[model samples]
Target: MRESASWLAPGRVNLIGEHTDYNDGFVLPLAIEFGCRATVSPGPEGMLRFTSAQEPDPVEVPVADLAPGAVPGWAAYPAGVLWALGVDLPGLTVAVDSDVPLGAGLSSSAALTCSVGGAANDLLELGLSPRELVAATRKAENDFVGAPTGGMDQLASMLGEAGSVLFCDMRTLDVRPVPFGLDAEGLALLVVDSRAPHRHADGEYAARRRSCEQAASTLGLRALRDVVDLDEALAKLAAEPDGEVLVKRARHIVTENARVTDVVALLDAGKVREIGPALTASHASMRDDFEITVPEVDVLVEALLAAGAYGARMTGGGFGGCVIALLDQNAVDDAARAAVAAATAHGFATPRTFTTSPAAGAHSVGAHHAG
Candidate 1:
């Protein structure tokens, strides 16, 4: 309990894939510049001390008491990481600060969990690889936090390189890097935070996932990811009583996975602009078929497109979050103004707009400045 350290983990934005990760589908995501930073030091015996710039009070828990749902609220994210790692962290103090917008589908929870987990990895010398660390973090969220998100967030946060898009295959854990030079290409990635927070533990997310699972089971497959002939699968679903809902869900996952492949290929060809249609199509599938996007998300997408973005789509778990726009760099200001005006006019919270480029994954900020 002597060594102390600081660690950082970047938040992530899924460029094309949505609701597909849990279905064991492919995903294309990149780490954002915004993320969480943690300062950790040894705590008193048998306890982990936790504090956050975002939270008002300090949370303290016995190191041996780490368990699922034991540490409620935001603290459970980090605690779950410790528990999943099977490490006996008797005493550690965590101080978190983040610029990543929570509830905006930017994988802030993953950022927080990985930041603390990375710090613990460094201080404890766990010697886990990027994939292993993310797997532990994923278990923390799934089993400990009880949120059924797939491994994309953690993987992207752990393995993403600056200026690169991570083309990840959820079924295989294969990560392929695609260079992202949007800024240099005279384009900007605009994130319009609709500010309508989404909680993954909510019934809606779990229900959608369950629907996909049932569809996969009904189709005699392990997951929807196995369905190669989507049209044939759609025809098969048409005969079931509640098949329409399941079909829509399956359709979104299948098509979204396809979009991920398309976007990756386009990026590899240095055809960033061509990826726009895939983004927009992905958004539509999520909206019409998956039924995830809320009004705020939908509106922002429309605004971004109207403002001349090559493509605009919601970028998170939906039901509320941010919409991303791929547009000329010079159009960023106009796009932001348009989103702000549109949201405020519609009686929603004023949207937060910002530009981001792919950034580095988790790393230690070092213990030199640790207080």
Candidate 2:
């Protein structure tokens, strides 16, 4: 192997909290073993170069010319990170590679963005805090990549610790590290990719975002975070014609925020068994209240649960993607087999199944230091 210093940024699995981060609510997410690794060396000149394990060509772009929509496909994500970062400093070069599957709801783009941002900040000696870096990554995704995603994935990728799940308050950027270490005999965390891709460009996600903003605007709140109680807020919304939609949106945020807190407590007490039921409740609310889970994800979760999985729910933005399940280690094979069988029987490609372990956050490898 060649001598290289690299930064590894893990893709994330949001256990329950979904669509809450952008609302300035809460999220429970963990760094997974599968992620993007960028081996960064300081360029003698201002050039940004990248090659992915999944890409056929090495992409090289000038740091000075970094801008939104400047590249296409996987290249656009890293480019957006650079463009966002370049707003604050002089630019450089980079190389990228990863095992994180793209658009499977494992946050591949966010991982790549975090890896590039972390590498650039380290190698260039930029003194940005993790929170600041997260903001930058969010800006990259929202403005450059145009995803309009929440801050969960980028923040989780930037702040994750090995053997831990992160309890993050998106509004305050305060994080509580919850130990998720499972001994060989303990339960397991399994991720099942539905193989049904997610399309952020589709107006559905953007529409949801707009609805959130409209709710905030109607309530005279800067963001949904200002609403201390969803019931109270819904009562107030009763005067409006769109009260039902706003109520549902508020319901998802409030209930999801509460779930994150509950899950944190469960993990803190080593009550690993309790997480499954919470996952189930969350998926129910997401399906019935939030209406984000598609039939494919519903089938996968149902199949996993039916096979005696501890608990399973659709993960990510939910129109299509993956589901995170908590299962007894012994039952993993059965759960995965059931999920794959269900997807195949439904005429979907057999879902990809794998186990997840907590991984380290972004940091410098060869010649760089943490920014």
Candidate 3:
């Protein structure tokens, strides 16, 4: 390891629990092996410099006060991490590279942000715990990048393990790792990229969050996590029909929360084979009820399922992006091939496919700064 070195902040796949985080709900996410790798080194000028494998040039920023929507393009993610890090630790230099596709419904920005934060923590010996890293990265995204994303992605990227799914409570920040080593059983988690991207700053994503807040406030609860199901919530909403926005928001949160709990219980019981149905249900709910899934994503999921996937559905914030499916290992290649052919036949751009496995959380892979 050099005086400074690189760290891997991997992207996450949410098994279930969509659009429920802002409502203080539970989420099941597993960090995938693919993500941003930040190679960092100390700078004599007390400046932060960053470059990405996907970018044309390195973007540089000062180690002082950072602003929201400050730097443009991919640079803002790592730059924002550095700015957020500086609030706790003063200065450093960083360079980032990533395989995680940006805005492809994978938490690429969160990975880069956490990778930079992890590398900076090692370089500065900030002694921040993994939990602290999660908090810092979330702060960076919210305050610096101006994306009001929940902590699920950042937490999964920071606390992931190679063979486990993370069951996290967004309200309490408590995480329990659930083993998902189904590869030996001839089952694999496949991600099919729909090639459609979602923008977090767009009005649609923000509107959903605002709706959740409105619902929580109206219900006299801190968040929707306090509730159990949508039917009970609907009855309350019917008492005040004017609260239609709150009703819709509460519906998504409550139903999604139940889905998360059920999926986790199934995983715990070694019922990996039973998860496909839940996955399909989640996608449909996010699409028809939540109104997040776009046409491209819906088509992709349908194509995958039609091709004999155990279950398939769109993952991420939804306007357009990736779909994940559970498939028999032997059927993976066929499933992927059929998805590509179907996309082409439907006049949609071909999608890429990759096998996903749980990955470890953020850790120091390089030598610490000399004391």
Cα error, candidate 2, residue 248 (Å)? 1.7
What lDDT does each candidate get?
A: 0.88, 0.80, 0.80
* Candidate 3 or 1, higher lDDT: 1
Candidate 2 has what TM-score? 0.90
215 in model 3: Cα distance from truth in Å?
A: 2.1
**Could you say which candidate leads in lDDT?**
1
Instruction: Write one digit per residue (lDDT tens) for candidate 2, span 77-122.
Output: 7778767765543434568888888778888888898988877666
Per-residue accuracy of model 3 over 31-124 as CA lDDT, tens digit each: 9888888877776465667677777887776655456676887777777776666554334567777888766878988888898888877767
Better of 2 and 3 by TM-score: 3
Model 3 segments beyond 4 Å from truth? 65-70, 86-91, 197-201, 238-245, 368-371
- Superior candidate under lDDT, 1 versus 2: 1
Candidate 1 lDDT, 101-181, residue by residue in tens: 877889999899889888888777778877889999999999999888889999999999999999999999899889989
Pairs in clash, predicted candidate 2: 5-366, 47-93, 48-93
Off by over 4 Å in 2: 1-5, 42-46, 87-91, 199-201, 368-371
Question: Whose TM-score is higher: candidate 1's or candidate 2's?
Answer: 1
Worst lDDT run of 10 residues, candidate 2, spans: 85-94
Native RMSD of candidate 3 (Å): 2.3
